[model samples]
Target chain A: MTALPKPQTLSLTVNSKPVSMPVPQGVSMQEFLHEWLGLTGARMGCGQGICNACTVMVEEPGKLPREVRTCITGAHWFEGKTVRTVEGHARQNADGSLTLSPVQQAFVEGFAFQCGYCTPGFVTAATVLIERLRAAPVPREAVERVVSEALDPHICRCTGYVRYHTAVRDLVLATPGLVTA
Target chain B: MRTFLLTLAGLAIGGTALAGLVFSGALNRSVVSRTVETPLTAEQIKALAPQGAKVAAAADCYACHTARGGAPWAGGMPFETPFGVIHATNISPSREGIGGWSRAEFHRALRDGIAPGGRHLYPAMPYTSYRGMTEGDVDALFAYMTTRTPMPVGNAKNGLAFPFDQRWTLAAWNFLNLPASVAEPNPERSELWNRGRYVTEALGHCGECHTPRDLTQGLRTSKALTGAVIEGLEAPDITPAGLTHMGFSAASLATFMGSGLSAQGAATHQMFDVVHFSTRHMDRADLLAMAAYFFDRDALTDEAPAVLPEPAPVAADVAARAQATYAGLCAGCHGAMGEGIPHVSVAMRGNASLRTASPSGFVRAVLAGLPAQSFPDGERMEAMPSFAADLDDAAMADLTNWMRAEWGGQAPTVQTRDVAAVRATLTTRHAAGD
Candidate 1:
């Protein structure tokens, strides 16, 4: 019998937590996060690259920020990169109780989800959007423009677009001292 | 409070305008530049084209004409339909591939079902729906295609065996029902309506499945969007009459077109493929436009009046026959009253799945049965047994007819010939792993 190949392990930071997992060759980042780590937040609506449901931020030190589709991307390709998921936002308070992040809170309050299947994707995308906006709070015209751009890849079947727009808008509006101008 | 109100109003208006501007500009940009020149110069046509062209190339067109490795677009793809198998011609740049044809001839092929040589192409080419394409886009596609390196693949002669192979009859069929120059959308309608019309007619090719076909295989305009079974898959009626429980509002249809999962049902089969390629890439406004046009069409007109159908009294013989079949096969899972078990049996009566125009699904369910499901919601899991091996065609037909007539549905009777044809096709496709 032929000798079994040695398994390879890669170290990566997920949602700010350092984790190491053994991954086979050609395993996508989406598969690695979903199957190996049990993070089902990223949905696989369409296996093709066209649907952006599996978008994830890949953070590499001293490099431009990159957003990659976990489904198409191989786990070995993200050997040392930090990845964030919707589960990462459940923050522990000073007293040790978990609190929902602002993006999560906004989503719930806005009644954004209908079927709630695509909700996690929206939350993660909104988290990214909020971070981007805080760095540069765009003009009101730009706000709509930016929101559309940020949410373009996400596909939501039930709530139509009204609730998603409402949630994102509310999140941006709630940011104190942020000016429309 | 006053200051906040004013600010909010101003922001809303400004945001709407800016968003509109950006979307319109993006659409215009995509429209204006049809071809993108890449650095690499591969002689292969598919290699040189952009992503959209590649997707278009991978379409059903490449399966046949190019099967024998002849010049691209030189028609030689053979399509087997209920009528017969017809060979597709060469569409490449060679003398055989419309080398002498002008832009009008190409447009005629797409929109009017007419070839450059003034011959009528079979409806299998989908020219009826393709004609809905905008003149400019069609021209661009032609330009991009002609620029590609021409292959010398020869055409395959049609394998059609008899009276069915007579090509002249296709002309009469075209004359009777060919779409007249891709009917221009009512200009007075909203931009969304116009866009939807273009997408539905040209790009989406909804008629390829939704519209019922005549005996000659031409689309029956009278029953447009009524829904039909294409390639074993039942293309659900997309009209607002809402055959399925999920009644699609214009907005909901737009969302479904964009995402594939609607409140009605998850996109499967060819629709799933369409969403994967075409609709998902569409901008929200375009999707909305398609929704607006479709929802506004006469196809949405309801056939059922305010009053429900008068309950049909089951004939003693019919009832006994149906009862025996149901008891032996289905009653174990679906309760005797047809109320259905919580997660096991789907009720035969009044179920939207049973009411669809195409009976292929119902027949398939009775013959081959539903696939096992282990979905998260226990409520969603359901299965049916295949009776193909067990029940004869007559018994299956009687059972289905009984279900429809007894279950408050207005669906017509299904013939055994239809069932046999669909079964044969299904078997061939299964064997081919299509």
Candidate 2:
């Protein structure tokens, strides 16, 4: 007789709400977000973590938020951590209206995505880069290099990456303290 | 009685003069003076060149002689040593190189550590090991070297300090350490075993890096093939007992020598160069012979460390942090349980580097990372990104100890200082432009 895999208890904060659930051992975070929690904004484009379409923000206490690929990572690995998916980027108002975050707003206005399969990863990665720059700004001349480094790992097939990169660059330039002259 | 005193004084003076000449290597000229003729005709050169080329490959002459982005055998490769920086000389057949050298001069340079004009070569050339090469192999290599396209590059000057700059001092070193005779077939041993010994010792010179050095920096033959630390990395023991402990059978060992990867792990650093330039080009039969000679048996019992070692005691928070780090960064490619992805990464369980007592190899891997390599056998591994900018010394120490204890079955002996030390080696090399 084959033995059943034991369910592991996973406790973490997703989208500012504490979640506690029993997930199967080795269940990827993408599965938990799509099937269990019903927050599927982070698309699973390539299950091998190469595409970065399933990227999400992992925010630790006293540390800057960082991007983690959900497709290849186990849900239990995020235990006791705070995570933010693409759905969490837009703020919900008291009037039940949504206000897009600066990165999301810039992406929408700049038409940074075409098929939108890779937009979520770009948004999360850009958000982290902006947060890092805010804490310690780069020289104005280094903006392009830094932007390329931030988004170089994510693969976008629909758009030639010029639109998304421009959107992020313009957003950083327009923002107050992201870069120095 | 007066006549006897005078005679004794004369004998003492004569004995002292002879000893001085021998120690200074002044007598090497007479010993290496025999002439060997080279092939003049194209047909003769062609017939002899193939075997000569094989001899050169087996001896690994190109890896040292050829500089990165420089002409092959038009040597400008710099080897950093404790004494100084020594550049490999241009051996191409040009007026500026060894074209003017005679066959006897070449032999003297290789076997007697005495170049043309009686200039003593520093031991950095590894003449101590080459001294054991057979005369036929030496002549073959000489013929092959002569065929190389003559590049008009002059030899670079060595940057050695005071006493080391004096080449004559090397004669004393050679007198003290040089092997007495060239490698010969042992009639008592099997033919295959004898061939294996010749390849490993005389041609391949595996002991140059693998064997520990004595206080004088001479190879300690007493502990041959037991392994040693070279250039901040451990060349792990390849002796019979050592290979057995590392879970190597004869077949696996031969595979590893031929390619860079095996069940144990991929070769890194200096050993990678050895495989890429030398052993990979070697004949299959020779590789097997080397393995057989290393194991001393055709088949090994193949006992891996079956019993997992108990985890070393550490603070709960440290272990927890290391697990989280591993899960976050490493698990995406190397499985969550350290099982490792096939053709992607090496499994940590039976990895020979991790299983070793020293954590230097593992620590260096994390810091320097590994370049993607494709083997001749269609095996390839993805490049591992360096985490030097991401992890702090304490974090690295924690992770190394955790991995070693959990999967490697090794003691948690790594500390923050050790990580710092390894990082310093990388920094030093970078500053030196290595």
DockQ: which candidate is best?
2
Off by over 4 Å in 2: A1-5, A13-18, A38-72, A82-181, B1-33, B37-41, B67-78, B84-106, B113-122, B146-161, B165-168, B297-331, B336-338, B386-434
Please provide, for model 2 over B293-326, each residue's C-alpha lDDT reduced to its tens digit, 9 standing for 90 to 100.
Answer: 8987543355453444455666677788787678
| Stretch of 10 with least lDDT, candidate 2 chain B | B425-434
Regions of candidate 1 where Cα sits further than 4 Å from its true position: A1-181, B1-78, B87-104, B147-152, B161-171, B179-181, B229-234, B242-246, B268-284, B297-358, B365-434
lDDT per residue, candidate 1, B86-120, as tens digits?
67777677766756566566666766666755565
User: What are the per-candidate TM-scores when only chain A is compared?
Assistant: 0.85, 0.96
DockQ of all candidates, in order?
Answer: 0.01, 0.24
Q: Residue B306 deviation, candidate 2, in Å?
A: 10
